[model samples]
Target: MAALYTTRSLSAYADLLDHAGILAARPEAAAEATTTISFATDDSREVQPGTLFVCKGAAFKREYLVNALAAGAVAYVSEVDYEIDEELGRHVPCLIVSDIRATLALIADALYDHPSGRVSVCAFTGTKGKTTSVYYLRSMLAEHAKEHGLPAPAFLTGVEYDDGVEQGESLLTTPESFVLERRIAHAAEAGCAHLVMEASSQAMKFKRTLGVEFAVGAFTNFGEDHISPIEHPTLEDYFESKLLLFENCHTAVVNLDTDVAERVLAVAQRAPLVERVLTYSLEREDADVTVQEFERTDGGIRALVRTPRFTRWLLVPSPAAFNLSNALGAITCAEALGMSANAIEFGLASARVPGRMELYPTESGRVLGVVDYAHNGMSLEALLNDLRAAYPDRELAVVFGATGGKGVDRRETMGEAAGKLADRIVITEDDPGPEDPAVICDAIAAAVSAQGHQAWQIVLDRSEAIETAVRETAGQAVIVVTGKGNDPFMLRHGVREPYEPDGDQLKRALAEWDAAN
Candidate 1:
């Protein structure tokens, strides 16, 4: 039997409704006459004369249907019920379901031959640490498989890896169901024994992970995030969406340090299907995975991380407690996957996430600088808190912004945190797509001002802002540039322009500052 659906393939979409517990009857036509269909997404644009063309959220548009039909799409899976009418799609064949999100999930399972059922998978979710945690688990599992001489473990992450198993760069935290299932199928075919992924709350809110199985899941932490028309409506919604991961996973590794950790843990355990649970924490001493001791050196922080199963001191250059929690979460999940101590240590020592709390030295001053992808309030607060604790006596300057369309909730919260915690604030542009830059800065400024923050400035040109923030920092002060960690592009007015002078730029500017002095 062929693995993928062909033009003559049929639908299990009605069966999906019943599974979701909707009060809809199965369409009799779906079970009997097999509708030979061609469903084309970006993965395979080439199709036979009769293919179902699907245009999905965030990346999808009507133009895709036009192009796909030109390439021979006889059907369409669209969000809108109205017709895009042409001889090809007008009356040819299209399945217009009430919810395209739900339908896409059902089709994804069918297309991938339901790979989730055959594989044990773990999903890590949160405002921070999802990417790092996924990598940590993947590395440990891969190393374990290597030492045992077993089939290599495979993974899907923000940064991808494949030993000819065809791992690709994942643009989204969680991809669309169609692409995601296809990728998982690729892993299974390549002899993957296990899978780990970074599951985003966006995946749940948008129904991206619908019908996906989760053998293990973790919640790193949560705070104000993704509050836009295209994202979640409020903090309540954000929490609700993140709650989905624990609900879906059979076993959960939760962060005991999170403000709502206890409530989330209770909810997950209360779920009828959840069988096992674990907790990692920096605060709560009773956590299954806890940081027994945290020590900072001239190099970086080193500490003994412990669990009931084992204990070891991990030395790393990553600069935040947030990163520590991320490492703990990954280690906890990896240990659960039956990895050995050696494998866990190797993965922890080697793991590095590009945009999360990456630090460097400056030539001009005795001060250290940091660049982080701390876009939301939860992440920003953690980063700021860590910075303060790391250099208690040194003054702190923050150069950051809230991305456009995420609204003032995160910006306001972040600003409030900065005013309370930071000595200097430089509000700058961060992917202000389709929204005025100054307008976004104003919201952040309002939050800071409401709390009576001092010595704050606005420089919209990002490089100029970083330079200004760096230059203004006197002796023994830290310059922290954040918001767009390792992202290559700066979005503005719906166009992705180049932004090369990021973290490196801060270092180079610091060099110039020293040169001038």
Candidate 2:
């Protein structure tokens, strides 16, 4: 379906470019052309009659512009001029701008009636806990609103999007500026007063989140990830991109437990955009929000928190201790946004992140299944070590694989961690993208063997590997299925095929094992 738009003439829209701080230098004849833009899109396939096609990205080519025009685009927005057939150029106006990304953001904001101005936009950024924090803030806001008889908050994270009505899988951690503006617009129309989201390093690096001024910018711990030729080239570059969120936010909330907290705080404080800074921590007693005590209960983690406004015990219904820090960071943001203590407590108690430390137990007594999206080595090791400590009696077993073309270090580290902790292991295929799955599994298998662990098997098919892991240790150990959790598909050779969810696959495996036994 087409988005709502208000038509603006080429000359009129060009006139407003100065107000938007965009330099417009087009031929007078082209500017005077009677073209009207009723829609704006960055994708050529979405171009329609009177649409302004935004030619952005390093991959933009003349063919995209030609196709957009052929699809009835009245104008093209690009940072550089493109050659077109002389006759075709006369009908389609090419609007040259200094920065197409920033221009597209402004245009989308205008077309969407400036939705961000109407909504309280909150954003969380970090390497580890962006998605989890997004879920926490959304749930807290929902609880606060429900208590006051207000509308539910909207959300957009890497895992899913709640557009004030329905929830669906997300295309990106942070979508393109145009798509983001449209979703925020829909959120506003649905009476959502708050919009919580994740500000990914990639999105911030490309200025995809340029227009909105976040009401609260929250940060979790930063670590080494997303470094590649196409992504951030260095850890410093990645951290700098994550810092971009603070420059456009009104208030800042940071986790004091981060190793580089002082540096991050200094950066945020020095930025003229930040008016307030709040800190949360599990270790520091003097932070703005501090966890007084935390313990691993049978069901989950329970922590007592202290803040100037209130002191409360938060029951995080998850076994991961790292989640206590995530909750505190989110609770600080919620407090900064004026959420009551009751709402915070209720939200933390009930909010659950799908596929992050999601637990399942089989009908048989001794086989427990845990599914988590701990794809990288750091997270995998942390989860495994924590579970080992928490469940001393159960033998630790893991089913995991490394993603191809990325996380090259993860294969070795994951294998080493499993070898040191897990009693048994199963190495299998993950998203191998353009690389072969067998090769990816072989790397992990070699790593595990190098660590002098022999109780491991390599299964190229992930479902079979999961089933084998369950069947072999049905009544002896707790099996953790890692890498792919609730993800819907497996990426192989640039193609994604439908995949069985971890919970569903575990249930099927358990049934099969029970029947055979």
Candidate 3:
């Protein structure tokens, strides 16, 4: 772990919490107020000497705090005091606050020296296309940075993160406040001029992005997703949470083709922090950026994009027509950042997101196998519809499963879409967290049956499901493997089990077919 570049004394934390109106009680030890904290963390396992431990989450236990204290935590913050036992022989200060999550964000921002203010931070929020849009925009920023002899831009998305210090697969769509602030700090320290990320609805509602102000915030589109007891209780709550991104941004880019575009535009226009609102659309010419025409080319999609600064042809190196909208959102954001047209065109033409509309080479050269992260009902439906249109003559087969314990509505929605649009359906497991995979598969199968598509079967193993779909429809169909994408684990019984990515599995299946035939 990187050493702290800035340190704060115990009294500074107390003062900050007091000013924020969340301080419930101050530490009893007066001398400890002047002690400087070397590090801060919420995980007890990561506690080090002079660490200021933070108590967070409903699952937080007293033993965790005890562990942190044993590991040399000198101070702690929590909603309720976990009074230290005298037998431990340590005098640790405690700063109690009314809201632990908000307090953590405040402290993290201060500890990281408000890194977002030092970098051009761009964020995107929506039910779908956030990951793609972030990557698209990051590519554009990378091109601009390269031309100006600047450091490569940093990015955080659902698939991966490149914070200039570390690059790896991301576990969350939006990380917790402390981690988020730390990455932004790393990006700024590495001399990166721009940082791009995706803002999930849960992040906004829980204040995970509390103190980070975005230079540009883009809204891709809204849909029925992330709706469950543990998530958003209602669709309105989800939509409203996404609107919070615009509240902290200077420029807001919105997709005017969305069903609720008018309302989203209104909210963005009314936000006190938003100085400019830019709209993009595929169907509307009045939008600030519009796609005049788009068509699939040999290995990619070509489009004529019209923006305030330029009206010219743009080519995205992907076959998915849906990416045109994502490209337009990126272009509008790049425009707001004062990037040149050449950078936008060159960056977009080379941008590619892993496991998003990725096509695998088949041995026979006749079968088309694709892997995508279209997990939700709306995204899955759109993907299937696009595939149907792209391969009108070939039979469509889909291998997918709904995640368990969250977004329960996706089972029926995904099944219905596949049943109506696909000729073959293979139900499989997808992150059945603490729930029976068979039960989730059964629910999806029932929904598929309702659509009068009997060409469906359950395969609990996701790898086998992809292989089966590939082998069964070899030489004559388009097979799509969705939901898990290139994610490397499956959540089973609340544990992440090692699993092969959908794209790798598809490639392996194709290779085996080639070996046999």
The model with the greatest TM-score is 3
Candidate 2 per-residue C-alpha lDDT over 1-517 given as tens digits, one digit per residue, 9 for 90 to 100: 3445667777665665657667567646555467778888888998888888888888888888888889988777777877574847464567678877788777877777678888999999988777778888888999999998988999998878987756799879898998898888878888898999999999888888888879899878887777777688888998999999987889999888888899899988887788999999989998999989888886789888998799877898888887888888889999999999999999878898888888776666566678888877667877888888777888888999988887677788788778888889999998889888888888888888887899999988889999888778735567899887789899888788899887789877866776676
Better of 1 and 3 by lDDT: 3
What tens digits encode model 3's per-residue C-alpha lDDT throughout 1-517? 4553468888887898899899999975574566788788899998888888999989999899999988988889999877785757766788889998888888888888789999999999999999999889899999999999999999999889999998998989999998999889989988999999999999989988988989999999999988999999999999999998987799999999999999999999999999999999999999999988888886788999999999999998777778888889999999999999999999998898888989986666677788999998889888988888888888889999999999999998898888889999999999999889999999999999999999999999888898898778645678899998789999988888898788888988877876776
For candidate 3, what is the lDDT? 0.89
* Candidate ranking (TM-score, best to worst): 3, 2, 1
Sliding window of 10 residues with minimal summed lDDT for model 1: 23-32
Model 1 C-alpha lDDT per residue in residues 413-447, reported as the tens digit of each score: 88888888899999999989878999898989998
Badly placed stretches (over 4 Å) of model 2 are 1-6, 9-24, 29-35, 89-91, 474-476, 511-517
Residue 80 local lDDT, model 3 = 84
**What total of clashing residue pairs does each candidate reach?**
7, 0, 0
Q: What is the C-alpha lDDT of each candidate?
A: 0.74, 0.83, 0.89
